[model samples]
Target: MKTKVLGLCAASLLICAAPVATFAQPVAPTPPPHVRESIYVPVRDGTKLAVNIYRPAENGRAATGKRPVIFVFTPYRARYRETDGKVVEAALNDQLALASLIRAGYVVAVADIRGKGASFGHRRGFQDRTEARDGYDLVEWLARRPFSDGKVGMIGCSYLGGTTFHTASTAPPSLKAVFIGASDLDKYDFVRAGGITAQFNTRPDEPPSVDLASLPVDGDEEGTQLRAAVAEHAANTPMAPLWYGMPNRDSVSPLTGNAFWQEAGVYAYMDAIKRAGIATYFWGNLKDEPTGQTLFGATNLGSKFLAGPGSHCVPPQGFDFTGEVVRYFDHYLKGVDNGIDREPRATYWLEGSNGYVRSDQLPGVESRPLPWFLTGGKAGRQLGAAPGVAGTAAFTVDYKLPPAEYFGFWPQPMDKHGLSFTSRPVTAPMTLVGFPVAHLTVTSTSPDADLFVYLDQIDAKGKAEVISFGRLKLSHRKLAEAPYKNFGLPWHSGLTKDLLPLAPGEKAAVSMTLTPVSRIVPAGARLRFTIAGADPRQRNLKDIQITPPPRIGVLHGGRDPSRIELPLAR
Candidate 1:
């Protein structure tokens, strides 16, 4: 969590400092103060984006010469500070990393997207076309500025990381490179994994604030300027609040502007980015933990789940995060001839081994496919074996039951509300490095059912560790043939397509994708696959409300072999 400022001696080499914890008070060599200023940069539609520029300064004056600009566009009001020993709380002031970048002799510009902050415009949600174009305009403007060296790169985490993705999609000429870490690329996939609205998605939204006091303005001069800007904005025009999440499929409409429901509907515009071929440096966490504040950046291990070209690890451990950023920017923006790009395209952290595995391609392309068929037997014996006989497992959803009591963990009291299948203990190590898919035959008495599939690893002592899970609305189960995208993962055209409801007792094939994982199941470990009418764990969060069928059934064995596929790396 600590920021390590590295000096750029040569455009290509970084003089890195020892890694330090950001919030944990360490003796960090304070670099020269950076001169901070705010300006409004107008975009194509006459809308101005409020940008805060931080340039390296000495003796209260701008430093000599120009430097490549690291532009960060965020909607989450840039003012930020370390909250606990692990997290950062955001408000308005300036990007916490601005000083670090400036001290490193790089110009840093953090801008609020077109609709937020002191910027003038209707603030739309994430990845708005206008926001992306504003980035292109801001980059070109920064490149043309006297303090800029005509090379610009975008940097940040979470919201800013998302903006970087969209901006790259625009393929602006001045955007030379980008460094992104842990941002959700696909809005639909992230918001509605398994066709269920994520608890994080339902957060209440923050409205656009044009007031100068809304920003983290410091000192008399900056305060006076901010007041003047606020007055001018008011003299010319005016503004609104947004909801962060939707309860059901139909509740997503009212939040078209400045909200998650509308903003996250589209897929990540990676096609244009790939075509533009800008130097890209990206990484993500293998697992997304819904904790503390709402920072919507979770990488579905299945979506574009690659390793070496970039790297991903389980967060709060393993890597030196800030060091990685410095190394990447030094190579690309600083023109450092570091062998980063030449390194493996994918690197994954092995959970149990506490070591990293590198490969040229994720899933290795040549990796073996391990398929385990769903069989008819006892509830715990529902996985593996041949389809000798057909059987069905049923579960009921009771709306009267409180979310807490219904969805609480282990030796779960609600086991009667769902069905689980456990696999035999692995005699040796088993490594799965890619996406997992479930081919299920389902029948529900209700018109639709929200399906949640969980994968857990149980040790010899029977401690179950939830590894990954995926969901799909039975009605939104239809798949599209974007075969090239995400490879084997099932793609659902959510909200956009018709919701084909299921009839009473109608047996349908449900192709479900369990969230991708790259973990080692050690010896004597058992893999448990669980299916439920609703995911109680998420339901207990209060944000996620489940309105599933009274009862749902999973059919296994017989001619219609319901199976789950795992990608076993060599």
Candidate 2:
């Protein structure tokens, strides 16, 4: 199941966390009847990308028929070995996925992206233009191979999945389709969500070190050499001491650093893919691990790091990830005439429910804006019906303290540091399918302050589950004109040119749209809108040294009524 969230992230952030889904069990299979070969495929720049091909074999010999190709591009070494000098098997190297396609009479080619594996080049990061071009070259090369038909299809998850879309953007003639499971579509926003860095970005999963001399020459020689080079690079460029390391981390391409917002630069070319009109499949989860991230999106990229329910480290048992890919490839590459393309471009998992909802657009439901007013008190407030009478509430925040000290789920924890508004218990089930928005009238004592809001569902038992979160550095409150808008969503470019400082002590209107969420607020459950000066609990929370003035005030129920609007599905 897939879900969606708002876009963009902070300048200095680190990202981490991967989620796993439960897979359905499959019958035991015989040894793979395929011929495996390790070869180097050259790109336009003369750099060779290490590739391992699996071609169907009949009776221990290569099959004679030409077949559609399934190409997978990955930075995570298409082939590698363990420290004990044992050659990693397909199951360990994602070869099991290829076996499924091979059995179905298709050829699978897994390539080590340039600079990562035996492929020669410098690593640029995810969706680099060079990588995209490399994909184009690889696809064309595969199409012309003796064992391949003219059609080529791509499939992968995460980095591999990113390459699928990047390659498709070039509109490779031989590239007929792309299937992305979970990938970083909105690269920049995901790394630094809402101008705050994601916590995962800080701790990256570095590859295991390999001994160049001890490597087995009989194994993938190029892969062995590549691992050795990577190890050497790591040794020479050891990470800086914890606090002095690069503030911003890039998962795909780690150049020294990039202009903060340009992380999603790869997406600038998505229009080409859309115009190419290739059959595309996107699989995302509404609830995945490492909170606030999303798995996939067709065009306007969806949320990047969402906190879903699954563990990314373990693959779900029983479910066949390959079966679904084969179905997609069969229809697009082999012309099997399946109704795959006729289906909606997206399939999202509805949170709080077991089944999925398909739609040509996100959210998949019609919704109306429901506004809740913030009324009463300097210490706390109730999220009741829009007040017919006006009221004002003031809360003080000590910005000098660590955000962790201020982090709290319930209203009481925020009693001295922040303020909140709560709704009455729901009498019926309500599903929120789009971005939740909050419009506030505020005055700050300092030039700037950050607003962190959490939209949570408190059950009849009082246990709280954070559904979605939103943040805005007060200076970045200015909204940009978006190319596309859904559910009256507000857009921010996060560009330096658009940033405006808050006028001290003057009332200013600020409107923020929290991340998109899809959940059924069960009966007898209450909806809570909690606000704080800082969010210490955010997965990517960083102590950016941003200390708002001693106090921040929120004015409500007058000409400028402070209220939050929830998008409830009708």
Candidate 3:
């Protein structure tokens, strides 16, 4: 297989540049001649949403038959002026994929959300209730259109994917199925996960301007309508202040005085979606933020999940699941007897093995927890099956540690900044297939400190590569029962009321679950659990910085044992 380096973008979904891989790419079906039309779709509030429709054509005219409509609701412009001065579809990144669906006899519609695109009206907040209601209106409208078969399905990635969940939550009658990729179900958890603020979430919104402005709909020769829409976007609410101001899930937004996070998240309306009984397919990358969210939806809402290896929205090199996507839509939208409903509920990619695993249920149910205790030895710190003699290892906080590139997926040299605990080489191959929980008994000179834990696989040659990582703000260490099914993993409420500040020089037990991973550890390879004070990738606006660097001590062996629990596949 050819090797490729993926570059991560700092968007909400963290889109990655496409990398050439050896996997067979999906070949598009020979497309039927299609007629493209641009028009305005008016919603409940009379706000005009810009929509582009691609319909199967015959003899240079739109076909006269009704077909299921596939809809894409996006904040990104439905169509935008490219640098080459040509207007093109901007919502769906892959035109070939869109064309394939169109070739399959589906009428594809792409719409600009309320503010960001060539649509009138300003955004209240990111994925707010109004936008969701607009989705309901749009879906119903598309179903009622002349050529529509009265069945509507949604498909998108990133923000567009989030819109699908938001729309599905409203339980629109005509909306039947949805395919979502790289979307966060819990907006609060994504923005301030583990009580650490994501820097990208707090960055200012930078809409397209100048040469890359939103394209005007057909018949707007002077670009009058597009210019007017851009004007209204000027009044759109700034997302940074709203995100930065809300420290807790229940915190009110400064702009709207509402619990924006709660209202914006699909988690709040999961029941509504379940009641709607929409067929759902979630595509997530194991190295991305949406894997856990995908598992949660699959377990709770009976959705099908495709978990693959890659950073952000990019799939592993050579791994293409577009054929499965077509199968899903055919089964649900067209009522085809494709037997997709009888297939495995979850499918995931294994890293070291470079293969896929299918399960009747979400991962972790058929796995056993393998605990490795952090123990101190004469040959430095080590991870063992049982607790060793009581001991403590000290490390000073390092604020200047360089951040890992590619959102921490790119490997960096270890032992340069943080304390490391290495496990003895394994005798046989072992497959770890789920979340890894870290339990640390620590004492810090400061009242609170951030703990960044990394799980690495080390070969006999002494080369180490990061597998997965997790972080927690010491003050947010208080665990709470999750509101939904969370696979029995550690849950931190991230609520202001649940915050617990540690006393100076006092021992505190912190437990956090690292991001999910699936990898096979070869025999003669060792596992290393490394803990650092800070990672420059994420920022905490409320982090307490002491005048002098604080010293953190990890207490282990007895009473307050520090260990990592790995989910070994059964």
Evaluation by TM-score, superior candidate among 1 and 2 = 2
Candidate 3 lDDT, 221-327, residue by residue in tens? 68888888878888788887777788777888879889888898788798998888898988787767567767776677878888777766664445456567667
Task: Estimate the overall C-alpha local distance difference test score of candidate 3.
Answer: 0.78
Q: Is candidate 2 or candidate 3 better by lDDT?
A: 3
lDDT of 2 by residue, 1-570 (tens): 222222221111111112325554334345468887877667898876677788888999989988999888876666665666556534223323566777888888888776665565655444667778999999999999999988899877656767887888798989888876555555544544444543333444355443232222236545555564455334322221221232222322234354423434445566787677677766544433222223235445432121222333222232335566677789888888777656554444445544344445555236577888877755447787765357656666545334542223222233334777788898877767666789887777777777777777888998877676676767767776643323346655666567667776777678887766666677899988777776554433344544444366777776668888887765
Note the Cα lDDT for every prediction shown: 0.58, 0.60, 0.78
Ranking the candidates on lDDT from highest down gives 3, 2, 1
Residue range 1-570, candidate 1, lDDT tens digits: 111113211111111222323232112334447677866677888876677787888998889898989888876554432333222222112222444566678888878775555566654554667677788888889999998889898875556766786787788888877766555555556655545654443433342242443454444344554444444443221211232344333345354623344444324455566566577655554564211001111122222222211212223344444455556677778888888766655555545544455444543244466877766554445567466477777767543443543312122333335577778888877777666788888888778767777777889998886676677878888877531345545776555455678987788888876655666688899887777766554543333344544577778778887778876765
lDDT of 1 at 518: 65
Better model by lDDT, 1 or 3?
A: 3
Extract clashing residue pairs from model 3.
23-318
Q: Candidate 2: misplaced stretches above 4 Å?
A: 1-31, 82-99, 184-186, 200-224, 231-264, 288-296, 299-321, 344-346, 359-361, 378-380, 388-418, 484-488, 536-543, 547-550
Model 1 error, position 273 (Å): 2.5
- lDDT accuracy of residue 346 in candidate 3: 73
